[model samples]
Target chain A: MKRLMNRRPNRASKIFLGLLPFIIILLVYASASSQRLAENADDKLLPSFSSMADAINRMAFQEDKRTGQYLFWTDTWSSLKRLLTAVFFAAVIALSLGILLGVIPYLHANFSPLITVISLIPPMAILPILFIVFGLGELSKVVLIGIGITPFITRDLLARVLEIPQEQLIKAQTLGANTWLVITRIVFPQVCPRLIDALRLSLGAAWLFLIASEAIAADGGLGYRIFLVRRYLAMDVIIPYVVWVTFLAFMTDYLLRKFSKFAFPWYYQASNKA
Target chain B: MSILLEIKNVWKQYGDAVVLEQLSKCVSAGEFVTIVGASGCGKTTFLNMLLGTESYSKGKILLDGKPLPSEPSQDRGVVFQRYSAFPHLTVLRNTMLGAELSASPFLGIVFNRRKFSAIREKAEKMLESVGLSHALNSYPHELSGGMQQRLSIAQALMKQPRMLLLDEPFGALDPGTRSDMHKLILALWKETGITIFMVTHDIEEGFYLGTRLWVFDKVRFDPHNAEAYGAQITYDIDVDQSAKRRLKKELELELEKSEQAFGASE
Candidate 1:
């Protein structure tokens, strides 16, 4: 039975990657809240920004310069923090679930209509229900982020999954391998190109969602800072934030592309173009 | 030799289109049997039934004594015509997949490096035997068609299966490569006393590889296909030919006589 059971649990970078959000969240929080380490700002961190919009507003302003919109580089770094968190989380979830569903046809079929409906709903449409259900928490925003980004990510993953050469599966089975081995040993590895593509896709959507999210919510975050400056029409601050988001997203994409190239050197010659 | 593998009264159909009818064959241990038939004559269907891929409407296939499952495991390894090895994994991994797939699933996760390091070493040695050692880290796309088939053979053999099932493993290769692979398979058979069940359309290939060959010349009396394989066609030839073509004529006559001796259509 054990032979039948026990797929490799998450290990290596996959485990590090799976927990990355929590780590990065803490890192960003510590760094951003460091200058505001006064007991007052520290206490407010948990209570503030119940949702994506609330978080953005926190970055915008609230009479305190420590946590509020600042002159130049500070605002840039604050906005970069918000963008990176959203992008990294969005990219990971989308690529993971999207590729999973995309590669497994039965999963794709079972969730196909629901995924379509999920996509049709505006990316930000779920926040109201999110607020009611989760009651002003990060769950709503995170789930929303996952859903919003997954559609495009899933589409890309499905394309990549389909791109896997059928011959490989046939060959594995011919060699006396059961079904699961084919997925782990063959389909999964072969789908790296699509996984990379899906990561890039979700990353782009995450940035867009982050902006929209910060637009409506309550507290501190890069999006909130942008809206803060929006009242003052501070295009200068917005310019830096926009420039940094673009740069960060580009960096995420460039880094992932490089990683995929190095990790799966065989993808360079894949007959199936994803 | 206890009929190492047996196909009994096999009939197959894809939907309403019938592909095989009452086909039966018995292969002995340490024997190489090749099936030859015209296009759509159920040659592959017979092979599929033996390997337990396609179902037989009314037949039972036995390996040793137990019934063959829906998917045959370890008992048979097939080499497909296309480049079927996973390109993402190296040739070593591909060959090792046979052994890897059969081991405890946890073994794949725990002690992975240890498991793979050993399997990989064994696979590299198998590749060396097949003349594909240089492709140890190379992907299937990196190797030539002949090399891929050899890798496929190595993969099949890694499991140490009792029989190797080849579905035109070399059909996609060039003429030279095809013969080369045939020689490799033959040599491997001589080295290991395993049975080989191969399918081929190349007439010369069948003669070269098979100990006992069956040819479907559309000459059999098929009660189901009266209008199609209908009455057999008989050809008239001058047995006494001019001296100009004597040698080739004798060879052709000998071939025809053997075909008749093996129950060819009148």
Candidate 2:
């Protein structure tokens, strides 16, 4: 406690220091926006704070005349639902496949080379193919996110599973665990935290795929709204939408980190020592 | 002193390179047998075969006058030098793993909640026996080196196995901690009457801890034919050194190079 108190800056001050850069960016943007609006009241390049607020209020508070629904909440719900569905299925598939490949050499030899080949292919390069194969719909978008991130997540988790020491496996066997028992009881628990870690890393790519597919073709989503507003030079709506997406991604990553720490406290403490 | 394990001229070879040749030993129930050997002298390999993780090229190992299972079983428990306790589990959970595995090998302890308290109670008793009752919820990494080893030993003993295997169990501990562990092992042995087969690189530790000690080394090695030789029991001694002539004869047999016990290779 003494050492913590004796530090140059306290924890609260440190947090404030961390927020300084964000404050500076906001100030610079506000100045640039005000100056542009003063120069030309019709300037759409840098929308004023009032105009951005007006746009958000229209999208969030007022229902659209044509659709009879709030665009902001509808877009957020759709995008989040699609993203979560894709990530959930990808995590499930990757967890099982990674555990099997890591434990059984025969399965690893048969499938790992194929997984490696697939992982090397750029996910963006196959976007057109996904649309072509699955067509321009929800299926294609979700599949795009799954295909974009599944192999990488699987590979990450497979490496983690393989990193489990030989001694632990042998010990489990000595305790009368069969092959299935070892995989489920011994290997599965240890791999769960790694799965969350892999999912957290692949979230960025998952969001990128979601936005790209939505931009290409979507009726309603944050990405679609951004692209739709681009024609009218509605910088207010576009910038807010972008910021919202970033906030959602940040929240997801934070939640996953917190969940892993909560569920597997031992993992965090053990890894901290390492 | 009933025979608990019998090895009949066991020979282990990998392809054409021999690792152990014509090795045999009889271990009785409730006896502490310490094996001291140089590095690369097949000590770990022999232990692996005993644990049923590795296959022998020829001969057989019988436990309780029956052929031992080809794979590891609940009858024999092992404590490795490192990674003895699962870092992801608490001390109590690690100790309960054996009973949990045996009870429900399909689902594991997580879904076996009906018997969890029983297992936890047993594990707590074992931890108390090993002087780690206060660390029940502590992860393996949170404990000191000596404490970790003690937790591991407690984990192995919780199963009540007929035989226990220790592979360089105290090689990484400091002298002070090692001495404490030595007392713990002796006490546990006296209380449980479980046969212990330990392999160590410390000659003094082997002599001090065992009722019987065996030194493994290459009896014949040709420099030109590097793969021609294999390890065998070079010296076997009963810890009872009352016979002065035999004690001196055994003491003169490469005991001066005890310091090289950890360094000398095949």
Chain A TM-score for candidate 1 is 0.64
Model 2 Cα lDDT, one tens digit per residue, A13-66: 999999999999999999998998889989999898888999999999999999
Q: In model 1, what is the error at residue A264, expressed in angstroms?
A: 1.0
Q: Which stretches of candidate 2 lie over 4 Å from their true place?
A: A1-13, B110-114, B243-266
TM-score of chain B of 2: 0.90
Say which candidate scores most in lDDT: 2
For every candidate, give the share of true A-B contacts it also has.
Answer: 0.61, 0.80
Error of 2 at A68 (Å): 0.7
Model 1 preserves the real interface contacts to a fraction of: 0.61
- What C-alpha lDDT values do all the predictions have? 0.66, 0.88
lDDT of 2 by residue, B1-266 (tens): 79999999999998878889988888899999888776777888998898988999999899999998888888898999999788788888889888887888567765656688888889899999999998888899999999999988898898788899999999999999999999999999999999999999877788788988887877786766656767888777787756334554555456445325425432
